[model samples]
Target: MTSALRVLLLCHSFNSLTQRLYVELRALGHTLSVELDIAERVTEDAIELFQPQLVIAPFLKRRIPESVWSRLPCLVVHPGPPGDRGPSALDWAVLDERADWGVTVLQANAEFDAGPIWDHDLVAMRPASKGSLYRREVAEAAVQAVLRAVARLAEGGAIAPVAAAATAQTWRPSMPQSARCISWQRDDTARVLAKLRSADGQPGVADNLFGHACHLSDGHAASAALLVTLPPGAPGELLARRDGALLRRTVDGAVWIGQARAASACGEGKPFKLPAALAFAAEAQRLPELPASLERPDDEWGELRYRESGPPGARLGCLSFDFHNGAMSTGQCEQLLAALREVKRRDTQVLMLLGGDDFFSNGIHLNCIEAAAYRTGDSAADESWRNINAMDDVALELIMTTDRLTVAVLRGNAGAGGAFLALAADEVWAHRGVVLNAHYKNMGNLYGSEYWTYLLPRRLGSDDARALMQRRLPLGATEAKRIGLIDRCVDAETGAKAADFESGAIANGLALALSHNLAQRIAAKHQARAADEACRPLAAYRQDELSRMHRNFYGFDPSYHVARYHFVHKLPQAWTPRHLAVHRERGTAA
Candidate 1:
């Protein structure tokens, strides 16, 4: 048994959980201090006054300053699980209709909510009122988890942090009011319901038809009310009224009013009725076209919205490639290359957006590759060499030659050529649930792309990259990051957590690691040249092997085998030197 502990509680609002913890700590004969409205910065007064050996921040909106944290042991009670660190965690989970949720206690770091977790307690929810669930169930779970964490800390026992993989499949931020705006033209009833639920009980879900203003309310489970002005020549618009509900017709769909308030003559009294003449005039005023319902087109996977508060030109330029339908055609490739070259001339930083939602790409179109090979009527070795070389050129142009910083944001499944495209970027940011595969080897083709020969080795080491190619491995986002294939992993579906990618964290981290005092010395000598040359032989070897593989695999339908291999093998193998050395030598230093 351990002695009682000193605890400090930081919170914006005093809730039942905070009260419970206060009582529990006191009952245990522990010292407890409470602070309210703490900002990100820590004041010396606070440190001196509390002088806590262990600091516990529960329901605190502000980030703890390094000054305070560096001095003593501090733990944050996050409302969500390891990867679920962010504001609005509960709201998002409910809106997404997730089956499970949890709370985590982590060592606080400069980076918000990303610290290695100490312990967590999972919370299971049934279909109940969102407000009640949050206030009751979530609060209880949080307090209990915190108490356990404190006990563990006192005993000096290690608490294993849950791996990101242990969590659910999707993530998203708390729904913003903008997300709730209903577009009559683009959205269906189901989508509308989702949006409403996302912002359910929030201030903006329902709005006045005339001014388009939403009602302001507290919490997310409260009833919503709205006001509307009817159009002229709208018959019996008040034909139906039940309770406070009002029914009206629009140019398109029939509008159902769940609840409404009619403005008084002076707009100052209760049970007020809008003057008939004024209501007519307000409706007649020329209003801009009402937006269509919010329906996403079939082609759109998803979109990422970003706000930058940096200097002018600080925002990176975006270079987008749509592999949505399929791989780029020769013509498309040529056009893309030309555009990239032009962007380079302008010195613009570029971020490539591949297919939205679930795919950066599926890789080279099988039909295109097969046609080219058949037309040549060449030996397996000859056709493979040509195809690999072509792919290599495309990859190299994007990865090596571009002057501006390049990043690839992948939200979906990427395979073969798609994987290479991501690797080519200066940094790769992927959602946590993304699937990445190197399907080339199984397709009877070696991994033929360019800088991948160099980049893969730099990231995963030559041995690992070789194994991956040889075995045609497919990886989850976490595995990809672990092997250095991708720079960072995030939950793509929810966009909730601040994954390492949001602020160019990956690029910055890599730059720190790679940028060395010896870099200047190495650049001055022929060491860089030597390393490049040493790798050349390996590239040539791989190219040749890849070509032969493609020839052998062609006409057999690579997809079936690739899929079978991934499902059956569980893990991909590494490529052999015997295969890779052949192609590296063919493309010389020119």
Candidate 2:
């Protein structure tokens, strides 16, 4: 193992990649501090204060200062192969249909992404959005490449020069609106999907919706029933609206646009992403509505789903909720509560809550809450109350389910209220690569709800629970298991491949495993519930948690509201928090 060094993390935002690197590096015994890529003076001050031996830039929007790079060794993680260099690397790769991609850990130089390559790890590309690919494939490859680069630096090893790009491997310019505009009169469903998928998260596909210009996101191919219901006036015509999405006809088929941001909502005519129907309420209400339930084969684009397996009395029930960005809005929480209730009515011996592929849940919908302030003349506080109450209802339902064994199979990362919501289940199963942030203090010291005060102490004792909450650090699957937060951590090898974690094959294996020995599991679950209820009623637990959460929502202290606003609006951070910027704290490691 390399000796520990004082490392500085400089990034545009404390994004997923930055968080993962922070946790992993800390685990390896390195002292770390973070500084956002704001002004050049701020960067200089951080460097001088922290006095870092090495700096790592996981994500950056602007160029690094030449002064700092010339003084100390800096490593830059570019989301492309060694021969590739550009601002729109991932975008062009997806649009151009590249089969293989990689993350390159190179040194900082005069030209961007043209530094000597310390290490690089290639990954096979899948048909996914640039955002999804970055979160999953790019993230995985980045960890490997970054670690290799760091190790090389520690050992003072020679770095390899980046090979010259062939004529075919020219620079990819920033994707323009012309390339993103969908030609409803000419493009087929596949072509349209590719364009939208390329721009899924950032600068969404610029297109016309309801005769108004808006950026389209969360695009999915329309189901057969949806395609049939359209009036067929012309291509690009809004066909129908269901759940929170609107269906638009394409040349061959149609696409279900789950969410859209109008060109007139907020900020320089760039609106934050809102549900398609909500953004165009008047127009969407006129379109035909489809059922949100997954029971219908024709249904598409709903956030929540339900399924049942196994035989007779020994059955397994699976309830999956795939909210965009894993956010549970007030309506989404209510729909999920109803689904959970219906699943309870079944005779299933075991129940599994399958969250989305990207995220299990990140707590209440901050974007939706923020939208309420502008859309409806209501305060964000009011919307927050409703959303939290709905989330509690869903958790209370699962907590009170004594008849069947409940399992929260986390296919993706769970944070804040979402992590506690998962704890409401009897058993928590997570994939190897999953990250869990159980604490809520990171959100401006907001005390969380979802019966965490009751759920956490039961799983982990009072002392460990308190420490876990105060840490405000991301927990990897193994550490979470060790701390008793998760019951089991399944390695990615149990499935067909490691990537099957994204496909939910781990959840399938979990269901099958429970089915093999379900009778005992259900009986034990019932007995444990009876014991816990006898000691203290579940109602008391809910009351206590809600009492505290009530303060977080409506208390005179407006820190939560202030924090929520800044987060939803994507405000730039003034400085790194003391928790992350260890250099600012006393008792610095030397």
Report every candidate's CA lDDT: 0.50, 0.79
lDDT of 1 by residue, 1-590 (tens): 66677676665544334644665565567776555533444233444655666777776766778887777767788777667766677766655567788888777778677666666877776443344345445655676677777887667664333332234323454557675665545554334434444443333254444453333111111111212333443421332322122333433323333322233212332221121222222342333222111122322211222212222343344444543223443433554555565555642333344343325665554423322332335433343344445555566566554334566777455777667767777678776545667546645444455445666777788898888887543466666787778888764331222233333543443343344442343243335435665757546644664554554545455653343233222222232122212222232211
Clash count, one per candidate = 41, 0
Clashing pairs in 2: none
Please report, as a residue range, the 10-residue window in candidate 1 with the lowest summed lDDT: 216-225
Q: Runs in model 2 with CA error above 4 Å? A: 155-169, 263-270, 296-300, 493-499, 502-517, 587-589
Q: Could you list the CA RMSD of all candidates, in the order they appear?
A: 21.3, 2.9
TM-score of each: 0.37, 0.92
Q: Which candidate is the best by lDDT?
A: 2
